[model samples]
Target: MSFTVNARKITLSLLIGSSSLMLFACGSSGSDSSAPAPVAPPAPPPATPPSSGASDTNELIKVNQLGFYPASQKIAIVPDNGATEFSVLNSDGVSVLDGELSQANTWDMDGRSVRMADFSALSTSGTYTIEVDGVSASNPFSISSDVYSDAHDTVLKAYYFNRASTALDAQYAGDWQRPTAHPDTQVLVHASAASEQRPEGFVLSSPKGWYDAGDYNKYIVNSGISTYTLLAAYENYSDFYQTRSLNIPESDNALPDIIDEILWNLTWMQTMQDPNDGGVYHKLTTLNFEGAVMPHEATAQRYVVQKSTSAALNFAAVSAQASRIFSSIDSLSALSSELQSAALSAWQWAQQNPDVPYIQPSDVFTGRYDDTNFNDEFSWAAVELFLLTEDTQFLDQYLSLNVPATTPSWPQVGTLGMLSLLNNGKELLSEAQYANVQDKVLGFANQILAEQGNAYQVGMTRSDLIWGSNSNGLNKAIVLLHAAQHTSGDAKPYVDAAVNFVDYVLGRNPTDYSYVTGLGSKPPLDIHHRQSYADNVAAPVPGFVAGGAQPGQQDNCSYPSSQPARSYLDDWCSYSTNEITINWNAPMVYMLAAMESAN
Candidate 1:
């Protein structure tokens, strides 16, 4: 989905199950930190090995291209046109397993009729295609333990590729390496963010956050959710990330690689605050969207503009979470304390300036993450502060609001606060308070899990297919997964639902393209990312999740179909459906790590 990155406001918006990231195609697809860069990052192994024995490979028969975990649910969607028995064919065209198909059913999201080929009974590890008697043969997919390892790593490495202010050394960046860009040491304080201490045009050195999306700009509202999601991932599954290296420059550091990556952005986030007032800038960007060019080639005046209640609260929430998370590490203890202080300062500024919202200036034109309601932001930030300081006043503020728990997005984050409470509040809250938080969280998770009733068997409804539908899907997985971990009951249903959503993202959805670039079959090659477009490299960076299908073609791009599920355009014009973002990739990273540890 390629459109101008500034159009990001238009949206309000997988898995192979091997040992980890079964929704992703897992394997040793690249050299590790100790190895030399390849002439090109190895093309992810084709999801399907060639079927030499002669049978058309049909694109309509969508399965998880990375395949399924041996024990996970394995249902392939086939066209509803009278297909009864389906055959699972090995690469040699030999039938390895056979199953009866479910009756054709219409999916309201797309009005496309499809049937399910149940093959969960087949546990053999091999690359195979599903052949329906009348419809067609599907893409090749492998079933094996740890089938998604390589894919998991590749997606996480995408962040490393998107890092700003640093030259991507060939040893780690491979052929994708580029010169340093947006050092951010010479940033201007826009008139909107000017204060008594710093006027308009004040030079500030704010550097090192990941580019917010396909755009080169960075937004605090977006980064807050993105950073918090990664921290939650690391907190929930520290064991999974401790040794999983993307081979970035810091892979050998004492801290976990994920922490190193988060720190890069966290440091930048800390700079967005005005040291004088504790108010935070909404975003750092040029006057207009830059052309598709390498980061080093873009030359424009960058400014931090507009202080808002939303931005300040987001800053407070993320910084508080970071402070608590890093306080345990001796090397980061002081940084933790500094972050804690900043969080409190930001919280105070928001209390004093509770209604300040971002207003794009007359001269400046960029992506505006404008929002009106600050309830979710306040609750989230307050809960985080409560957790960080062990101060009941912060907890009291959060609980007094009695905010309804909902799924998370940059614009809606109360659920994240609730998630944290469910995750860490039992020890701190009264039994009634803990149970109330638990009910809200588990209830939302149940709501998402119920979406598995759809014909596709993924926990996504038509409403879920928004601007960044892919992230919506994965965020649902995050909720179901948290439920699975929080409950003492059978975790299989929750895990299965989460796995099914991963499968949908990988290749099981209406569009056979795996939403992730470079990892699964027929991925979106020309994703709406500036770096990938301008890098001169033929392949887009691997592992960045493309914004999936949605009916609102806000980018003015042509579509294969108007159906919400098939409204995806893989070209650069389809920014509404094809752009990649830190927020989108964060859930993917979280879900992948969670899946790896699910077993």
Candidate 2:
């Protein structure tokens, strides 16, 4: 049946009854902390006589709450243990600042006090205040100067593990030290901070090649869905941000039109799928300590040992990417029949298998898969599918499915996967679908509100349920809220929460900084294990043949201690540079775009 997928244009106003009051009351009051002076604080009051009974000695003082260490000069403040929570305000009094410990609501679960370890940007130095849970600890501390030095080096020594290469090794050295020739490197050397040196080309080049000879098993690609979707994101990033060109060598001729290239990629994915159960597989030879393959068995995503790589591939990524492909026929008819046939066949397959949709958690082959929560990602995919094919079946499936309760304990992938579905579903579903999703969305949102505390930020891919702090989770929330705004009325809470997080990131003092406390057990946010990102780059180890290392040594592909030379783009981030694919960057780009829009 033909249906219109322009849910974006569908206008359905729900007079959410007064009985629907529960939806409106989302968000916890959180801990009551002393409010700081405005971000733009007024000139200090005349040295007032110590307030009655308020002991000036109870106050504490510090310069800046957060900044690159050694660069930002410290300030001083008088303590006041009279209040319940600590508060920091800007010099002029207005903007709420971040990164203070021993204050109310400062811990992010696990009782680890949150503090500012790095600053990626800069705002004016300001006055600050603090309190330890309702009792004022400090009066005022003013930061006098920036502390980051000229020789500040943020480059991290890391490993670059490659999946195809079947080995673990050290990272390239140039990643930290700039090359003499690159222009950006020169600018970075002179600039006060790495974030400030925005170069034109690959100026942030690093040296130090990785040693990939260690015996280890690499990551396996999930042919069913994740890969295709990631590919689409990869395609979008390449088309919009980096270079608007498509060059496939084997194709001989480059497709000038990006849409065409997208289609080509989509077609290619389908062709690779298992004809029987629709599984996709990729092959890599085994390796040894010397990086030599033993030529035994082929290892892939869960369902391996298949005859070939065909059946393993699915349309996971393509579903999200396909709608963006250019077309005129309401749904284009310009594509070749083979292409159309494959696309339609896949769509049909998805439709027929609605009860057993490609829920990521449903891996019959591998019992050891990650979180078994696929409803969220599936809901998102349904939205995309509906938008592309105008399929109501998909919409109904999505709206009818219940979104699992999300918590700080959930994995990042799980949270984002579900959030993406909530965020994007409205753009393609029918009014019923839209309303149902909106109500459900509100329910999910209320869950977030009900548990919010100043210190309770939902972790994205790690531990702790910190809210609006996770870059990835923020993107998901922002987009879903955007979709909600387009469907329902103002989703300002979601919008505000998202903007606050972005503002927090953007308002930092631009100086040398660090993030030692990672989200979960993976170390700090700044930890640079470069080798994890080089999966696509490394060729099979020279000595490895088929079945790489012995079973026990599969996970030992560690890298070197030194970092590699990097380009301007390379230096922009520590590890993500070498691993420039969709999974990592798509959410990032989406967040950037969203922030830009809000700005």
Candidate 3:
């Protein structure tokens, strides 16, 4: 089966504001000042109108919203009339750094020529803001070594905030607490899923997985890539994640906080596979999407939909990766063996039914992560199986497919297979094979570097800004980081490029709004998340990264411009622009962990 990437557009008939409008009424009584002889308090100094400098106007400063001090930092300023002079002011309102903006021939997507000032020379740690003479001062930012540490934990904990099946108590969830929802212990098998072994109406206990996105659904294909990224983070940076705690219920558990969090999803994923055969359900979803309500309020029965080759292969690949990672833990050896057995079984099942693809029934209305292309999935699974078991047949199958290197998306993950093989399976490959894989990796990295140089210092190209474009940037960064581990000649450029991509998502973009919720100076507030919408909290749940700017206004919300970076709305109504998903956040965790580890 082959699947094409399609953007899911949802039309909302009524736009319900996520925020409440509060009106304050002030009544002054004439007798209130009866003690006038005491001299009316000095008229409060004339109220200073709030400065609109940070407003989306002619003058703007784009930097990482969380700020930077330990590394070289560049501030992008768009002056009203090509003004050259700019000043950086400390929190004390005293000038700290002064420089002239270097005019650039390049123009932003919105037709504004972007000028740059390098304040990397000023390494002193302090809270600061940028002043462009006529424009209002830029938003205050901090310059310290640990500036992003809190944000790193916040983003990682976002997964906990989105956990299903378990209630998020105030103890861990803080302000985002909510009752448990989607206790999928008695999921029904869909009619289309009826097989010779397990017929329709069979009840399965498929409980516990992160909601796919803002919608309360779980998908295997998306979960595969998401779980793989998280595991890769643990694989590469065990030391960094082992001691870091996200304050989850499992913080006191014997396993690292990261491992505990991964297990929350892995346990649910394990249930998605059919024990009778190695087949896996594509997704578990309700008949239709729930409205803007809390998890407990959106009570809908879920059904495990039809099995697909993609799902089976995805399951196999992720299980194999998990098997390798968990084998080292003394308590998890048995579980590791189980995953390895499941992976091999799933691979065999997929081999027999290679053409099985996901087809959403007419009765089902949800985001269909449908992919007709199973070749990449096959390659990925085969590579993992080969690496885990040292099986020559699996390696031969992977080589026979001759999968090319490409950027990884949920639907297209052949490149991830190549990355895993190059990063971990080199000992099993012949010299020629190793060279071939190495060349491909370098080729892909070179392309990304060229794109970065041409596109506003960001690693993604204009075409990359599709739905969930932020993930595209982060996913590309993941590939680059992996490549940097192998490349010998000055890996700093690759690491810096990867860091720049993360910086863009954090707050260093034209929009000046951090795509992640509840972290930056102007983090997104109205994320299109149901729990956040129904929780009655003043802020959305922290750490979930939004699907960045895309020209396709699928939600029909008004955007400032169609330009990639400018086409975003921080409103719950803008589902296409603001919805968060596990796949998007997974790479974020990888990127942040990688950066922190490097530091």
Candidate 4:
């Protein structure tokens, strides 16, 4: 089960199925470049006939409000009963395509059966709107070959925008510029974090990382998965990422932009582990969530609080993965060794303190990523360490653990171990072992695809629409992509399923808004992010993906309905439904990049 330095380089031949779907030529030509060009303003549609019976007040199309891929299925929702036929008009008021809507499933939120419009045949590169007979035209959308390239760039750049201890200038940050804040060199070690080497008052220099979400706290569990996703992106698609730049402070570095951005948080994550025993702090946070103030304006004292089995195991997994990845990179070889050492030591610490979990004190009110389950974390660490060091003991531990095949999440990380085994553990694992891992991955993907009949036509089931529902969808997409890479069967269904999840986030869902900021025609303007609220800019930072529609109104904001997909608000007060998180955006970046690269 273990691997050695002499093991074969991980080579993946992703056999994506391109046969089920036909990629149509873009309707409007001359926009073949990777970056989108400006288009003529959309012309108004002709007046509708009264006999068409379409609701003139309601917008008919539901898409990723930003736009669609030239060859991808572009779905639209007709909320009211009326004409089943629709028209696609180009910017110059030319009717480019006309089609009849197939009656899709009914949604519980409004008791309206949505009619599906297939505009995938019109693969034209132009600004256009959808018209449903007598209904009002949809918001303008563009069809382009490179529709998601800029979106991929912006989502990755969001991590840099959320970087603490760094000034965001006009050059990269544009109008959302801010002074440097949270220089955490003097961060106090809380009572729970007191150890033989570092007492309660001990100070540590943990200066940089993206804030956990809308709040300016850092959670090791969350960051571990987020960083791993970014690293996985680089490992899987290095060719696409090697020269890709978002004009960050480290854009000129020899490392790929993705690696450079991940390093910013990796450096901070390194500081979370105690050099004395390799126990990682659960979180570095203020006593309570800070007020809605700019980073420079919020002056609360921060503390590195508690050490838990979850934190140690998470650190072990990420560090081990990092060690394996950076071992080959010339500039990061030394850091790789350090990370490997730290990862092994953290795994050792967790062995002695397996039952320890994060317990928030009575006064601390910040976000808690507390988890009682350590089995998944332990399995993940063992698999990662085994992959890097090829140590039989870690491999033995991994085999003994009952790792789950679920998608990667902060709490459930057994899937991370499963992915590594299926992706890179091929040389080390036995034929039966590889088959077992592959079967598990396929099982998860099949489960997701099985739920495709939900009202939204996205792969997510009703239960998946919880807090950070968009992340749930994106994580599921990640699972499907992995399955597509490994499956011997037709991969188109899995790939299309993954794309559906991304489309849901972009604007294809019932909410009619892109969960990500600044991409869609209608995006969350008042997301519960502090910088977005404090900055004088008209739009929120462009790429931060909001935690999507949650039926549970966990915060104060009033929601229109309790239906799974209808319970979202763009209000700043709706933290449960609208907060932006680094973990949420990481998988989004991965999904977008995967689709872009595949194309």
Give per-residue CA lDDT, model 2, range 187-240, as digits (tens): 111111112223222122211111211222211122223233333333323323
Give the per-residue lDDT of model 3 (tens digit) for 197-254: 7788888898888987887788898899999988888887777777898999999978
Taking all chains together, the TM-score of candidate 1 against the true structure is: 0.90
Better of 1 and 3 by lDDT: 1
Cα deviation at 257, candidate 4, in Å, is 1.4
Compared with the true structure, all predictions reach lDDT values of 0.79, 0.28, 0.75, 0.78
- Across residues 254-279, which tens digit of lDDT does each residue of candidate 1 receive? 99989999999999999999999899
Model 1's lDDT to the true fold?
0.79
TM-score of each: 0.90, 0.44, 0.88, 0.90
Please identify model 2 stretches exceeding 4 Å from their true place. 1-103, 108-271, 275-277, 282-317, 320-381, 399-429, 456-476, 483-491, 500-585
Least accurate stretch of 10 residues (summed lDDT) in model 1?
19-28
Candidate 4: tens digits of C-alpha lDDT, residues 185-231: 89998887888789888888999988877777788989988999898
Q: Which stretches of candidate 1 lie over 4 Å from their true place?
A: 1-59
Q: How many clashes does the backbone of model 2 have?
A: 132
State residue 443's C-alpha deviation in candidate 1, in Å.
Answer: 1.5
